[model samples]
Target: MTSTPDVIRGIVGVYHADGGLRGELAYLIGKARGTAHCGLCDVTHHALGRRREWRELVAALGVPVELVHLNERSPAVRAASEGRTPCVLAVTDAGHRPLLGPDELAEVDGDVARFATALRGAADRAGLRWAPDER
Candidate 1:
């Protein structure tokens, strides 16, 4: 794993829900006892090539990025998802912002230029520096 930037002020983390055995169990539990959990991180488990794309894109901004497994029970992730998974969240000094969903990203159709523009906008909205050195 690449190291977190020394001047870190934010994280562009992606949270993915599970769609496997654990997911089924979580569903049943949530139905019964009202809780949840995830089996895997979708972006890491699938999207083989796009993982590199996501990494390269985040790397350029000089901020930490993480691919984390998310389930409905995780309050922060749940609040971030707001009903969906594979959500990109900008957790910054100012606050948290749910930037995109996997489906929204797919709409960009592998266009890094478009993705970067959106990311920069999110950074600005979250009061984070796209160029950490400038901060």
Candidate 2:
């Protein structure tokens, strides 16, 4: 295995739900019925909309963070995220790597602070370092 740290240039998050209006509606209904759950969603959003904590976390990360639904994910993301919904990917010059999986995300339980901590830990474990700010 490559032990050298990869310079993380960006981050990608894949939600468990599909994209588009119908998919969103279905996810909402399923969520209401307790049949569908996305830990990433819980961390990033609330009933009112995107959480302030999430925005702050993103800003502090000093990297581009892109969140996408199931249908919105690229083929590469789909492959890395296959069978693993609600996950986070680390983007590096080496390519994308799985940074956090569903179970890890679920552990955060809607807390942005916890998620940030988890992300930092995961990145370290994965031999990743955030890219230096261009500014």
Candidate 3:
């Protein structure tokens, strides 16, 4: 069976919003969902682990990592393409915009290096404080 790290290292795709690339990175923050939790303790631990991992990663990058929970019709998507808001450019601004159709969606399953680089760039632009691990 492939471990989560293995799976994250293999992902390669240019996810786009409104037909533009939004950079590439290992999207491994939410892959553990749906797995049966052994018990209440297990579930709590899993959630805590996820939060810790995310915090550590973001801190390492030294940036303000905003988790944008977009609904089906995401305003960020619209703002990015139309240049209506700066928040929307969070993932699509830099030079890493993906090249694809407006409706096409790519998935980055495991490409860790690319994901890290992209994330770093985003963090730099966003003026986030990097953690020790990110250095």
Candidate 4:
């Protein structure tokens, strides 16, 4: 793949858990019990809510980033990321391409700076370019 300016339309991050109130409670309890885990969640959220640095990073990238739970993924995202929760996908005209996997997300260790670096590096390697800084 080769880099093309503005080719990437958006980014989709898939969480390892399900959605809905019940799902949220389940995950919260499971997480506290050291059972459930979602690396992407670690990167984007905290006890209070979404991380400030994460929001800043998303704004700075100028790319629409949608975070979805396992049950909320679109069909294309589901096909591309089945059984691979906690991954990041680069959405383009061609389709959704895997940018970062679970292990890669885990390596960020909930640091927004590290996650940003990893995401940018992965997008570059995947030949995807951010849309002109819309923000």
Which candidate wins on lDDT? 2
Off by over 4 Å in 1: 1-8, 19-51, 72-74, 125-128, 131-135
The TM-score measured for candidate 2 stands at 0.95
* lDDT, model 3, position 121: 55
lDDT of 1 by residue, 1-135 (tens): 333332235554444444468864665576357453222132323334345655576667666666555543346656766666655776654445676667655555546667667666755664555435432
- For model 1 the local lDDT of residue 49 reads 34
Model 1: lDDT of residue 34 = 40
lDDT of 2 by residue, 8-99 (tens): 98999999999899999999999999999999999999999999999999998999999999999899889889999899999887778998
Please list all clashing residue pairs in model 4, or write none if there are none: none
TM-score of each: 0.54, 0.95, 0.30, 0.92
Candidate numbers, best lDDT first, in rank order: 2, 4, 1, 3
Cα-based lDDT for every prediction = 0.53, 0.92, 0.29, 0.90
From the highest TM-score down, the ranking of the candidates is 2, 4, 1, 3
Superposition-based RMSD of candidate 3 using all C-alpha atoms, in angstroms: 15.2
Off by over 4 Å in 3: 1-53, 72-78, 81-88, 91-107, 110-113, 121-135
The number of residue pairs in model 2 that clash at the backbone is 0
Reference-based lDDT, residue 105, model 1: 59
Q: Write the per-residue lDDT of candidate 3 for residues 13-80, one digit (tens) a residue.
A: 21221121321111222224532112211211243343344345445544343432122224534444
- Please give, for residues 1-135, the per-residue lDDT of candidate 4 as tens digits: 555543888899999999999999999999999999999999999999999998998888777999999999889999999988889999887889999999999999999999999998998898777777656
- Clash tally, candidates in order: 0, 0, 13, 0
